[model samples]
Target: MTISLKYRIALVVFVLQVAIFSPLLWFTFTAYRDADLQQLQTREDVFMRLVSQLGRKALLTAEPTDFQLFIAPFSKDSHINRIILLNQSGIVVASTAPVDLGGPLPVQKNERNTVWKTSEIANATEQLGAITVHFSRAELDKKVEALVKRGIPIAVAGIILSALVGLGLGSLLTRRLKALEQATRRMGAGDMEVTVAISGNDEVAHLAQVFNEMSGSLRSQFDELQQVQQELSFQAQHDPLTGLPNRLLFDLRCSQAIATARQHKQLLALLFFDLDHFKNINDSYGHQVGDAVLRCVAARLTMALKDHNLIARLGGDEFCVLIEQLEQEQEAAAVAESVLHMLTVPLECEQHEFFLSASIGICLYPRDGDDEVRLLRNADTAMYRAKAAGRGGYRFYSHEQTSSVQERTSLEQRLRKAIERGELRLNYQPQVCLTTGNLVGVEALARWSSPEFGLVAPEKFIPIAEESGQILAMGEWILDDACRQMQKWRRDGSTIPRVAVNLSALQIQRSDIATLVRRTLDSTGLPANCLELEITEGYILQDADRAVAVLQQLRDLGVSIAIDDFGTGFSSLSYLHRLPIDRLKIDKSFVQEIGSTSRAAQVAQAVVSLGKTLGLSIIGEGVEQLHHANALREWGCHEGQGFLYAPALAPDQLHLLAPFKRLP
Candidate 1:
């Protein structure tokens, strides 16, 4: 039932040989027997013709001896079986067989012998008798047997040769087929690299070639799929903008670090921070610049920390760091400081230089919170506190700060609605010419009177506005309101020479302040010269070159620029001279400590000298005492503004007061 190809092929060949040679051998044997029988028949005919001629004499003589002599020769040749001579009376006169010499001619014929009868043997006048001859069939059988013996060996050899050829051809095909099968099996077992060797141009070879091509294509596709999977996994866990680990990945690593810390009873700290006023950068310059800034920040943060520290972008401007196996909590502070310092460097994007700062909050393991959730929450709380405390610093988590942070959050929400609720207004304080004791200009200040929390001070709310991005809108409101009030005062015949408006660092850095000033002046129909814009000394020093350009633009619009809170920041004198400023306002703290502290007086004197030398006027704020005013005047200070002159007052009240009057 089940047969190998070799055996099957051999059997088929054997069957074909037998079918072909069997017929051929039988035909050869049959032809040989026929030829031999034809010769035997020819000899019998000749013998009968001869006997007819020769037997006449014997029949005439009526001698048995004569008949015997004529037929004896043929009988001895082994072909003639018998010969008989009969006379006219139908009796056997002569016979080759002696027993038949006296008897009548035999009527029975032998089956194995061929009988031939001759015409009558007669004399000249009448017929005498007939002669009969018999030929043997055994010689034909002998010739056929000889032919079969010669043909059998050749046929057997031919059959054997055909079987060998069939087996060899079968082996050639099966070997290649077996190799392809093995290669296919290997491919099925996940070895896609396997290939079959092709030998000939036959179908099996073609099949092997196709298999090799398929294996290579499959391997290529599998490699591409694996690469795509790896890329997708990386994209899933990383920030697309910064290439830093995303929030999900950060949380996972933080949780793992916490576990390790817990098991080892080691200290770890979680630090959270975000860039201050980063939104302003995005709002002012476009997201392209914002994204570039974020990338730079991520790179700087990575460079700032140790290799073991894990840093991640929690999204947008926020980032977190996990510091494990810390020796002390103070180490976290050092790391935070390094990070802040690294951020302080100028970031250049699309030809615009930016000076950035961050407020960082750190929380230690077990001391602040046990788990990542609590730790991150507390760190975020501390960061908000750092932002509220004027930003550009770091704070450790404390239980006391949480309530205040919550309150700040509530206040920020209320402040967002403050402008719509009409809870905001402006007050103007009088600025006097110290030499003439006459009112010159009034400084405009923002005041918020909330229905829920009445009369919040500028000190409490301004920083909140700046940090929460509310300052941009508030700054616009203040500029418009101040210009409107100044115009109103002018309409009332109040000769307030100029109105000074304070500019937050956010307003200057995040927006085109010069353009806003021009728009406000045009809208209010006020002269640009009647407005003085005050910026803190520290903010100007952040990017002195950009600050100088912006101040120059404002000055070109005919508005006066003042450095508020002067001598407080680390300002380079080289940059001080480059500033397009009209006045330097001594910080209120220094002004208040003028008589109490010699160092404060000396700093105030130095500022006055610097301002005068730069051809700019000096204004001393918080000149509460008479001696403070006298001391500032003696130092060549041009103007003063404080409670001594007047607290910031309502526009109507200020209009009621004489514009040129000296306060008591």
Candidate 2:
């Protein structure tokens, strides 16, 4: 089915040779035959003319013997078979053969070997008998046979020579083609180095040259593609900014490490840590600086850990370390301490020095968890515990922490449903004018009374709600409920001036809090001036510019803004004057320490004086004793609130008590 190039070329050449030589050989044979036949024709004509001239006299004399003598000699010639002289009456007078003497001339018809010719013998218009001559074809046949015998060998030799030349040419031409075909096959089998040898300027040689160039191009492209694939694979597994293993690679290697640890019964530890207050750095500086810091942290961590231990960036400022073949469980703590110590040194990036600290959590194999997921989760929980206990420290996994996490998770689930089931309510604590004991405003406090856990404290569930991202919904509900309650109190003829509702940092950061407040006010038909929003000082300082913008929007809508727990956070006077604020609440710690410590008293007095200087109203919180209230009033505080006046009361109770004035 598949013919080789050499054989195909040979066949084509053989066919062409046959086509050309066959016609040439045939023409040569034909021309030789024609020339021989023409010579024979000339000889026959001369012999007939000679017979007619010699026999004329004899025929006129009517001498048969003389004619016979003359013809007999002519017949003896090889070309002549017989000669005769006839009388005018058509009678045979003489013949070389005696059988034809004195008989009419014999007629020859359909003869193979001989032919006859006749001529009239006349002298001076006197009619005489005809003379006849018989010519044999045997000599012509012998000459033609000899010619054919000679030409046969010559034609065969010429044909054979032509065939040999064709075969040789075919082989010579196909040799390069065959080599190219083999090279093509090798290239097809993935040998990009394969190339054909070029020998001539013909099409096949050009084709080989083109194939070689194509093979080189393909080899180069393949190498580039392989390199690109490797780079893509590395990028997929590595963090682009820090050049650390990403979460995907970390998970894979962690799984593998867990399996090995389980199989070999070896101790393994997973350390989870994240930079403390890293968002503040990203907020204060640009993300470029933050990225440089992360890279620096990654490098330090890599150097701090053992080579066998795997350290990976688990996204953001969080990282995980896998320590295997630990001799003791305390080794994990030692590693954690080493990592913390390594981070104690300041890092400089973009010409700024940063003091970095981290909270680390350690979970051991077969002790804290048996698998990667559990180990990571427990380590994260312990890391949070470290952060809560004040950062730059590490904590090991404990059953109490697991119990707490489960309890918090359960609380979070219940809290989500509690908001929908309307189990949450608001209590109003009256804020009295310290100068006149007149009711100025009341702070609306959220209270949750779950059927499963009665009267759950705000401190416990508030943080849980914030962490689980349910604070947005819960904050919205509190704002709406507080506004509606204030409206109802106004309708019931209560003299409460305004109602303050607390806002969490998550609410402001994660949601459009200004819009939410405006919508709530419009829906409740509550006067904006009659509503106040309380945000913690720490939340405001976290992103001061954005916070100022959001507060400015609220102020434009005639809503009051107050800084809650003012002195407890990193307060900056630079942004404080820029804030759209109406009041600053003295932190309860300072209020509680009023009569106990002169330092606390001085701090509170300074806050009040600062508020006065800023032309902002100041309120003292947790004023539990007469001395505390007297101290706040003497210090020129505008308002005061504590159990001294009243505990947070229900709406109806507050309505009932609104008319009464408290005297300190």
Candidate 3:
């Protein structure tokens, strides 16, 4: 369908030749011949002049003999076709036509000149008579014909020779061009092996050479593209990091396995494997070490699986194993145990060693659901149970387990719609001074009363909400609600302490957390000092510098920041001194066990002393026992909050509690 370069070049060349030669040939045939005709006419004028002089002499001398002698010399010239002299009476006095011409000169219809009278000539010729001459055009035609007959053949032969030479050169030019054409066809067909042979040093040859280089470059690019496409395909069906079958491949295999099992009436098991505290490892060390750990884990997983048992990575420290033709669920459970056991050993990469564990969940065919999504969800739920039960374990999927997962999933859905339904409310837990027993602050706790499921616990739905990104909206609602409550109380003449709102990791992960908090404070008309933002120490330590910067910005705005659940995170207390923190709330885990001769009590005292040494106010949480509150006060804790005092109450219920003056 594509035209070749050779044809195009030849077309251009022939057009140029015709354009130049056609005009030149036209000039030669018309303009040059016309100019020759004009010169012949001028000669006829000379003959006419001689004839006129002879006739005038003859007419005036009254001697025919003298006239003939005068005209004889002019008539001897061969070019004079005809000469006629007319007298005053329009009679022919002399004729050079070899006969007496007519009294009036013979004139052709398209005559060049016509004489009227002596009066018309204005008497310019005194003794001269009018003379007319006609040249022999037939003889001129014969001469012109002879010249053309002789010259045109030679001119045409020269043109033919030049055309042949031009065509030969054009053919030579097209030879390399043809090779380029073939090369282009091959390149289009995805065959880049073809190469053009360029010859000579003409511009066409140079063009061919450039085209060849371009073809080579394109071939290299195509090869790289092929490699990239293959890599993409591989990554599509497999995990790029672990080089193992990914979730897509896992789902495909699971669906097919379920179908085959249903057809053959065979038992199959789907096992979900989760690496325990994998994110913590990744955070403590860098992702590189974590990747090395994952690679080791993948190798262990593959080794533990049978050839028929398929294993795939389900992304982010989670993997799945499909056991085919299993006789019993225990068979799959045994394999899960093997994998968990294999993961226990310390994995070494370079000089670093990582110790990791896996929590495995098993779901069997015919007993569990017979579909991909159902079985995977069931197994994943059981795996979470195993992890919650303390990892280095395996759990078999049961109907109860499936129900729990469905409930959790359903809870997550409801939580998503919770804020929109206006089912969420904030309950204020009073944080009072242990000595004076006066309210110092209130912790904001989110309570959801769903129409579908009434009074869901925070522990049940908070994590699900957090994972679904709904926590951000829910957290914003809590902030506004709590701040509004404080404003309402201040307007109602009830002494209001700081309103402490728990902030989730997801909430603070937003870089705009400070802005959102400031805007909420401004909108609620609540002073920054009256609002407190509480974040767990573990969340703040994830990205210390960034978290510290955000906290410092909030602190500068007169907003109080308390490290909730202190001494529970793995961070060293020394970093706490440098943090722009206002208070440390001892974790309830320690406060609950205080005075029980338990290590939890010692941990609580350590955190209190650490807070005091750093000039930070220490608030003891979960202080249900009077002894716990007395111990915290003796340990220099500045505040206390727990069931030993009043628990969280609704905004209306806060009016009944004893109030304290706001801190200046």
Candidate 4:
């Protein structure tokens, strides 16, 4: 299907040369032979004229012998095969051939012959009888044949020369083309150093030079592409935020380590770590500062572990470490403590220093797991146990911890299906006006009534929901349900003035929370003024600026906002005025010890004084017993709720309490 470039060029040249010479050979042969024949004819005509002049004298005398002598020399010419002289009487007066001397004038019949007829004048006075002469063309024909024979060799030489020249040109062209072809093949085969040589300033040479430049350009681009691919590969395996091995790379290396440890019958320790209360850092500071702290932690980890271990950021503030060839399990604990001490030195970002702590879980090879997944999982479970054991510590993976995690996992699974199965309900807790001792509003609390667990506590599943990212949906449902219930209560001629719903940190951080709240208010036909949304102090301060912005949007809708569990976290009192909050609910911990000479009671009294000073309403939460109520009222708390008056009850059971305000 494909022809060689060399042969193709040769064939093309040969055909062109033949085409040019074929026409040239024909034209030269025809024109040259014809011109030579014409020249011979002219010579014969001159000789015939000379014969006519001399024969005229003899013609006038009417003497045959004189005419014969005059014309005899004419016949002696080489081109003259025969010559004849004629008189006016049409008889042959003289002839080069003696046989026709007394015969009538011979006819000039041969078409190839040169014949001339003329009449002569005697003494230029009287015209002599016409004297006709004829000359033969055989000699001119022979000369033309000689010329044709001579031109044959010349034409053959010309055709051969044309072919040779075409072949030479084609060879030169193909040589340059072949060089480029070879270079192209070499470059295609990944040889970046190959280049074509430019031989001249012609178009072909210019093309070759451009090709060489393109080769260099392609090589440069190829090298750059390779470098980019390498960077991308590295990025895929390592965390972009901290430049540490990412989860995927960690898993791969962990697997290899497990295999190697098994083969050498060596002990391997995997340390799973989670930054303690990391969300609080993101809350008080920002994610930027949180990321900086994580980077600093990674740097510290790398410095402490050196090249003997594999360290990885397993996403967020969680990192993993694989320490191989551990002589004993205690070595891992020592390493964990060393790393934890290094991390506790306090990381600084944006002129803010953070003292951080990490809960580390260690799982040893052959004791905890024989593989990567089991080892990583077991270590993570133990790390959570360490976190539960009050973080800033390390724990070894054990069978007991694994069972605990299994139970938690089962609980998480059941909780996920709880919402869809309608296993959740809202319980209303009355908020009493402390001065009036009358009900002002009610707080809606979410309670799960799962058939499998039978009244599981919110404290247990709330953390699971938060960690598993289910809190957002749950928060939305709670908001919508609370608003709807408040609307129903108003329609039922109940005197409830307002309904408060708890919003999780995840809910407040969502951009759509305002839209969702507005939609709930509109659909439930609940006035925004009668709906109070409560968020905790620490949660709101996570991204304080954005939280303030979102809270402002809710406030714009005429909704009341409150800070729940006040004094438990940053207190964040400096920005309390900046936040569009209307109330502060004293945390139960403080209210539990109220009226006692305890620090909690003092903090509770201070919170109430602070709320009043800031022109905000105060509500003491979990207020039980008569003394607690007297203490909250003395502190100028405007509202209080607890088991002292009544506990969280169902809607039907709420009517058992005395109606107040607008109860119909």
Measured by TM-score, the strongest candidate is: 1
Summarize candidate 4's per-residue lDDT along 1-664 as a digit string, tens digits.
Answer: 8977666776778778878887887788778777876786676567656666767767766776876776677577765656666666666667888988768866667565565555454556764545655555676677678777887887778777767776787778888888888899999999988899868988879989998999999999999999999999999999999999999999999999988888999999999998876876775566888888888888888998885579999999999999999999889999989978887686776777666789999999989999899999999999988877877999999999988998789888998888899998899999998878778899999899889778988887888888777888888888888898899999999988999999887676544778888999999999999999998887765556677888899899999999999998765666777898899999999999976788988899899999898999999999887788887888789888988778898988888677532211
Per-residue accuracy of model 3 over 1-664 as CA lDDT, tens digit each:
8755655665666667766776776677666568777887776665555555666666566454565555556565555445566666666666665466445665544433322222111135553456555455665676677767866885686567557655766777777667777888988998976677777788868888888899889989989999999999888999988889998988998899888999999999988978876765565456887888888888877776747468898988989989888887677877877887787787886466656778888888878787999899888888977865767799988788767777877888778878888899889888987667778889999999999888998887886776567888899889988899899988998776789999887787643888988899999999999999998887766557667788898898899999998887767555667789999999999999987889989989998888788888889989888788888888888888877677889989976675432320
Considering every candidate listed, which one attains the maximal lDDT? 2
Candidate 1 Cα outliers beyond 4 Å, as residue runs? 1-171, 174-243, 246-248, 255-268, 275-304, 314-317, 324-331, 337-357, 364-378, 398-410, 435-437, 509-512, 597-601, 625-627, 655-664
lDDT of each: 0.84, 0.86, 0.77, 0.83
| Every model's TM-score | 0.72, 0.68, 0.59, 0.62
On a 0 to 100 scale, what is the lDDT of residue 98 in model 4?
90
Give the Cα RMSD of candidate 4. 10.7
Model 2 spans > 4 angstroms off:
1-182, 240-243, 259-266, 273-309, 315-318, 325-359, 384-393, 434-438, 510-512, 594-602, 625-627, 655-664
Model 3 weakest 10-residue run by lDDT: 113-122
Off by over 4 Å in 3: 1-233, 251-268, 274-309, 323-359, 369-374, 384-394, 659-664
- For candidate 4, what is the lDDT? 0.83
3 or 4, greater by lDDT:
4
